[model samples]
Target: MNIDRDARLEKPVITANMTPLQWANTEKYWTLYKKESRISSESDRTTHSLTCCDQELRDQLFSIHDDIFEMNDVNMLKRIKNMAVKSESVIVAQVNLVRSRQNPEEPIRSYYARLKGQAVICVYTVTKK
Candidate 1:
């Protein structure tokens, strides 16, 4: 399917404060949209992805990074993911993970899955020192 200007496709808006899982979901959704819409052109994909991002995110990218407008879709998405995993956001994710709990009526499997999702944002590493 060539680019359909009239297609009622809702793009996923990426935000500056989005968590790792949220970012992953956004990327997945974008991929699905591309596949479903049969959008193969790199330029079209990049333009659509960037246009879906929130204003703050777009501004931040434009300010700190040069040649973003020339970037391909994969590179631009990678840059956005990197920005989201900064120190401040990681700290916030750790705090959220620490405070996470299952709701009263939630099942064990669902609770476990939720906790796992929350944990994805809290980067874990082992120091060789």
Candidate 2:
């Protein structure tokens, strides 16, 4: 299963609650995304269903395509929170699983950032091995 010589390259892409325009509200937002550096990973955390209201977020979780969406609890939905998506020295990444379907009981990784008034989520999911 040596994957290093696949002769394929993945195009670099970014993700957020809505579109690139929506994520660029401030320099801080860009900085935040740079930290996470992946679109699907960021979407799983900060947005309900990887989208806000009516905006259709990029479905980077799947190589094919999906419209899977998730929502926060009423409490999390109503509160103001700061969010950041990135990898860290201690953590490899924020969102590990961005798939077309998920079990409701599956645990998704997320963090509460107070400044952005939202929880940073990483729906790192595992499939049947």
Clash count, one per candidate: 0, 17
Cα lDDT for residue 104, model 2?
69
How would you encode candidate 1's per-residue C-alpha lDDT over 10-125 as one tens digit per residue? 87788877756877678788887888777899999888878877888888888988999899999988888776544447788789889988899999999998888777767776
**Predicted structure 1, TM vs. truth:** 0.69
Give me the candidate number with maximum TM-score: 1
Q: In terms of TM-score, how similar is model 2 to the real structure?
A: 0.17
Q: Judge candidate 1 at residue 115 and give its lDDT.
A: 83
Candidate 2 stretches greater than 4 Å from native: 1-47, 53-57, 64-84, 91-129
Q: Give candidate 1 misplaced runs (Cα > 4 Å).
A: 1-7, 85-101, 107-109, 119-129
lDDT of 2 at 93: 22
* Alpha carbon deviation, residue 92, candidate 1 (Å): 9.5
Top candidate, metric lDDT: 1
The true-versus-predicted C-alpha distance at residue 47 of model 1, in Å, is 0.8
After the best TM-score superposition of candidate 1, give how far the Cα of residue 37 lies from its true spot, in angstroms.
2.3
